[model samples]
Target: MAGVESAVPGASAGPELAVDGASNPDIDLLYDINGLTKSTPDWLDRAIGFVGEYGLLIALVVLVLWCWASVRRRPEPEVSVAGLVWAPLAAGIAVLINIPIRGFVERPRPFVDHSGLELLVDGKSDFSFVSDHATLAMALGVGLFVANRKFGLIGIALALVEGFCRVFMGVHYPTDVVGGFALGTATTLLLAPLAMALLTPVVTAVSRSRAGFLVRARRVPLPHPAVDLPEPRVADDATDTGSGRNDLAA
Candidate 1:
């Protein structure tokens, strides 16, 4: 097919210009989604970019901390906090796992392969087969879910929005985000049992010692039950007999 013009105002080339071939659904979808940014105000576009890139991730971190505080107050804080701690660990590990995937796939950024894309934030020189943001967000979200259901749901929702923003920003393909989601979920879920097993003991020990405040709030001791005892019987009869004998002798 012939090349089409880029909708972006400053785009010098179109998708077809870079790769001269029939358009596939991936590029087509990329163009369609990114095209929405053309008519948006520059400030709104910037806001979206910021939220997608950094703001949401920060929010997720805060949510994780909040969850930790809540779980620590539980009767068995160590168990739940262990799961919460695994979330960041899982996210870090997932990103490391993606390093090889990105190197192996060697998929260039959408803006690089296909021109006419409105690049939101620059300095993304690495391969783009799997989105690091998506992977990290989903991993944290899933880890939160493993620790606490309500917070986990919120985390998952934030992750979905993060995926959409990556595509909208023209930084990644939809499949890249999907791959990230899959990798994150699998890593967190698959290895969760082992991670929990190792972390729980450490958390438990911390909660029992002087540093227990980190795992749980100071617990108030229960009040002891009051005990009842019988009163001793009086010796009125013996006293009365003794008094009568003294009166008769007098």
Candidate 2:
């Protein structure tokens, strides 16, 4: 019996070894599910890649230009100057707050740590708790919205597209994008009012200083009333005839 036991393949290794060597069927199933691979379409991959790379920058530049043009077209010089100064300042604050918050979170990038996930673009990031792209997009959206509700809605839509592209590109996890968006929105909601308040004086001063330039460059001046006149005088003959008829009828 002793010889037979000793001859068994793993008998000498003990029960601990047996347990340690045992394969976990549950884990195997999970691994299979996790590893269930699907190929990304070439066009989708390319489109996602292009948007992920340059979309935000293009959107931001266009927004800036649009805001500038909108303000420039405004009849009120003060409003135009305010838009220019406030828009850039709000954008800057959003970026500053977003960067530090992302750095602190330091979450692992999806492709870096998640097994069986394919990365379309190689992103050298150890910190991926919150996506910078999403953050910036949200910030831009909120900032633009603050400046002008109509334009802000447009900005938000563009930002959402950019954030979704990050996920579709397999560069960031959905959670990362969500977190970034939340952080950005919170930052904007909190800081935008404060920034506007602080910038109000500065913007006012700038607009006043530049009023002369606007006056010089002005192609047109607002039209004013040429004259103020008294109520019109009806013909005395018509008034007397109407009065005479009423008197005769009475």
Candidate 3:
């Protein structure tokens, strides 16, 4: 209860909740989880923290591979490339949206509000309404999925892991992660279609150029037209008989 801190005015954050009397059940649950997590082994701490820190990179690799594979399998280079490109593009939009959401919610980080909370990673003074990490993770995931369901599912899993580690490491409340998940998912889903629609022409053009050699869609949008060959001709038997009679008269 003592040494509790809230976010600065004008921008709200998750202030310190009572150990037993948090205004929101989600915050209360965070306290219990963070408290228990403090006793985890050093290796586990690092493992989860590593996942939280670099999960995006891992997800990005998966996205690239999946996109390449999609192109290879279907040869629809434009569509697969769009899926790959839209992932980070959609994530960028989600990050932009997160800026205002943080100011609006003004939730403080869990470690800032609670005493004896240990940090596995450096802490930021930013408001914790929704986590940027979680949002981007999910945004990338959803965008990738929109491009290819298999890749999208993997991306979503990575996003969930990022959220879990953020809480487990005492950097965020569960609600922060949830808000990020929702924001990321919604932003990507909305933007993916628009991105695909707008970028398709560019992608199609690129596919025809020398650079198009690199933009393998793996699947062709329209198959080439079929060709018709000429039929063969043979001499008739009656013509051959007439030729023999002329030869005899000669």
Per-prediction tally of clashes: 0, 0, 18
Deviation (Å) of 122 in candidate 3 = 1.8
Tens-place lDDT digits, model 1, residues 131-213: 99999999999999999999999999999999989998888888788989999999999999999999999998998899989
List TM-scores for all candidates, in order. Answer: 0.79, 0.64, 0.74
Report the Cα RMSD per candidate: 6.4, 13.9, 7.1
The sequence of per-residue lDDT tens digits that candidate 2 reaches over residues 47-142 is 667777686758775985686556555566454445445555655666677677656655555444334443546644556657777877777777
lDDT at 69, model 3? 62
Give one digit per residue, the lDDT tens place, for model 3 in 95-120: 99889877766767766656556567
lDDT (Cα) of model 3: 0.73
**Higher TM-score: candidate 1 or 3?**
1
For model 3, give the RMSD to the true fold.
Answer: 7.1
The regions of model 2 sitting more than 4 angstroms off are 1-40, 77-84, 210-217, 220-250
Task: Give the C-alpha miss distance for residue 194 in model 2, angstroms.
Answer: 2.1
Top candidate, metric TM-score:
1
Most accurate candidate by lDDT: 1
Please identify model 1 stretches exceeding 4 Å from their true place: 1-23, 220-250
